[model samples]
Target: MKAAVAAILAGMVIAGGVSAQTAAPAVKEDFKPSSLNQPGQQFPQVNSQGYARFRIVAPDAQAVKVSLGLGGRGGTVLAKGADGIWTGTSEGPLDEGFHYYHLTVDGGTFNDPGTLNYFGSTRWESGIEIPANDAEFYALKSVPHGNVSQVLFPSPSTGAQRRAFVYTPPGYDAAAGTRYPVLYLQHGWGEDETAWSNQGHANLIMDNLIAAGKTRPFIIVMTYGMTNDARPGTLPNFDVKPFETVLVKELIPYIDGHFRTLSDRGHRAMAGLSMGGFETKAIAPKNLDTFAYIGLLSGGTFSLEDVNGTPGYKDKVKLTFVSFGSRELEGNRAGPPGQPRADPRVNAEALKGAGYNSAFYVSPNTGHEFLTWRRSLYQLAPLLFRD
Candidate 1:
């Protein structure tokens, strides 16, 4: 009877162990189908040749377009599978420089959730870094770099403080015995002193050009062009003449006194874009004793009549470089259907006839865009400060 009881107790213990094992909860799967909503998962890796296949997961959208400014537009890509993934290939052995692109989903502007954003000079958090075959233009080389300082100098003409950005060339201090020429660069409408460095990439462009021995080592001073608080694209309430005076009388003197600059007309140059270009034309010619080289990129008062009619205007200037994007002609001209307005090209030709060391460069297939201006800057720098 005792042996029977021992067997029954052992069986009961075994049964309890089996019940406990079966009662344990099963391991649950934490995976969710909605976690695949990320759009970047479809982006293709950019190759060293600057070619990349871009993909977007907008399965719900009917039409998707990629607006590549000056880099060529991408084809309409369709969504694939039930996952709503839209995929397209961009074949670009692109230019060896930085490019900006955005997505247009059914005529609406949208930043790529996956790629990087380069609106102006500031790099946004989202962007894909593309390695270039020869990134000397955009790459950070071992060459000596310069410092860009934003400072306020007292303007005697205006009796107010004015802001200017100064760029000291590499080895400026080390080469104490040597002095450098200065370039007064002005910004266009709706932009201030920071426009050059921020949007124009002036510092990088200058550094790269100097590193490649393409441009002479010089100082660049960028200042605000507009003096009045006028809405952009409209005429200002105040005249820009005072601002020009501030530059010539106050800014130049202060810069010369503070920095190691060749403080004479032979070593000084002035150039600008749009309204700034107009200022360059208006100011530089009037003060020919102060500026030797003048560059007008995209917009300026280039009329030969204006220059000749202006009092005391002569061939006192050394070199004048004029450039315009092809697309700007349409808006710059005005006339009725029967008779078209005078083209600025005629003015450019007249300047050439006036025996000014003048040259006009027209960028093909480009509009009044920053790309044209940036390219113009790259080409124009080498021509400056030449013996």
Candidate 2:
């Protein structure tokens, strides 16, 4: 159990933020407006090689910098041209998928006017998408889609009405008697409930997966993890008991009562990313009779000892899914002498060898970001609710 907790902490530190950019030998000239740009605006462009170019109209500002590329160098600094426009290209190509960034102009932070804003880093920041090779899996297609409806449920524990987004699969309303399994999904720290649908495209991923007949249709419930109270740098002191009560005690019952859900331990699962994963680790193992399947995406892993220590984990838990970005694993691969690293993959293998249904995944060429979590969900959805 200590090793699993250590691995979770290590993952939080090593894989929780922006990745360092790698330098490219040459820049390509085939830059195009990013798909995430404003309707008619053009400026934040991405090239075929994933290099991002920025053009900001901050004429009077002494300097402009973008908070998107190359760690240790602060960020990419933009140069002012005669037209009073600041322009610059990233030092190298960025990783594929969505990235949250803001402009630092004369020591003031702001969002770029050209691109659309996304809620991240606890605020609305400019977002850009570097096209991915496997992007088609989550792409918008002509296939039947699901509905992501906003639901306001009573939370007596929190003394307020909490908001959650529910994703009902295609034909959910049309099929009268067919009840679906439910997966309670969660987001990372410094993010809200919208991160899973807006930033991660979780609904689209499920839509595509179901359209392809790859996975069983299920309902997904996403709500705030009640983490906003934890201000910058005081996360370790944050308490989970309050949010746990809101989720396990209040929200789960509300969802079961309202939605046409298969309300049983075998049909219900819980998974989260980053700190949300930490919450799952803290909550699910203790409430073994509530959640049968568990997943941690770029979150943490379960050691054999951790599983053995729990009272009914081996008998009640159906699946233990753990995932990380390939780069996140690289960051946790080594530790100083006498301090052995707790490798999540090694822990997963130990669980499997001990006659447990454990699965481990790594997103290629990514870090602790939305793309990693997106791919993790893509891999995990098929393995859930197999009964």
Candidate 3:
């Protein structure tokens, strides 16, 4: 009887265990898609030498491709692995510069969920930092860095206070007795004062260039190019007149008053990109007494006739520099379509014909993008502040 009871007890324990297992919930069959893979998973890595290799796992995917741009060869790479991992090796050397790239999983734009962002450019999650060589335009170097200060001051033209960013050169206070020339830099469409220092890397570029003795030491004043009543990103309701008034009357006076500036056209200059380029042409010609040097990057609506028509065009301005990318026009081989294209060389010839001393530069293999502008700023900086 006791042996019979022991067997029954063991059987009961086994039955309870089975019941517990059966009562538990089943795992869900359908799972939501995730932007990133597991942490241990590896992706392509490239360096200044322009080499890249990516390890992607896409078990359920029939085909996977890696889209490359900027620092490396820009094309689609096919997946090669079988255990749900797609792998591809880039061909040839990549361009020695910062590039934006993403993954095309079955022709879908997917930013890598694992990597950190460079911010402002909003290109993608994953980015490869390319080291600058002698051949590169602006290489990173160890230099005494300057700080960028964003300040909001009263604007009498707009009636509402606006924003502007000031870039003081390294050792600004150390050179206490020294007053610096100021460059009033303006932003193009879809950008503000933040654009230059952010995507343009204006501060980093200036810091590196100044350290390398590539550019003259000066202060960069970046302000909102839009009018007071103007909506952000869209063109303002008023013409460029309000913008000009804001800069000349309110913005410049505020900056000059607050910061130690030379306060004359000889020690002051104006420059901008796209719409700002148009502003430079409009304001500098009329207020030649305010701005001596002018630099236009990527876009301008002025023709030789316009310059000739403007009052005091010849005697007012000292030097003019116009620049554009070789791949600026539509269907250009250097860049994608829909970029602004104005031939600086042609513009220079016209300006000379109009009795204005001008120089033009077209960077090879660049488009109407920040890459071109950054390089343009580096080149134009040295030419500034020179007697």
Query: What are the lDDT scores of the predictions, listed in order?
Result: 0.63, 0.86, 0.63
RMSD of each: 23.5, 2.4, 20.4
lDDT of 3: 0.63
Query: What does candidate 3's lDDT look like per residue over 1-387, in tens digits?
Result: 122112212211111000112232433323222112335534445433445556666788776665663222345576666577776655434443444456778767776543433332223235543333533444445779888998888987668988999999999978888889999998665356776876567888788878888788899999877732443323323377888888899888899888889898898999887556766766787888899898887645345766677677677767788876555532332211233334446768888777787877776555555666777788788888886
- For residues 209-303, what per-residue lDDT tens digits would candidate 2 score against the true structure? 99999999999999999886676446666688898899899999999999899999999999999878878988899888899999998777788
TM-score of each: 0.65, 0.94, 0.67
Order of candidates by lDDT, top first? Answer: 2, 3, 1
At residue 8, candidate 3 shows an lDDT of 16
Residue 221 CA error for candidate 3 (Å)? 1.4
Q: For residue 126, what is the lDDT in candidate 3?
A: 50
Best by lDDT: 2
Q: How many backbone clashes does candidate 1 have?
A: 4
Off by over 4 Å in 2: 1-23, 333-340
Extract clashing residue pairs from model 1. Answer: 59-84, 115-127, 116-126, 116-127
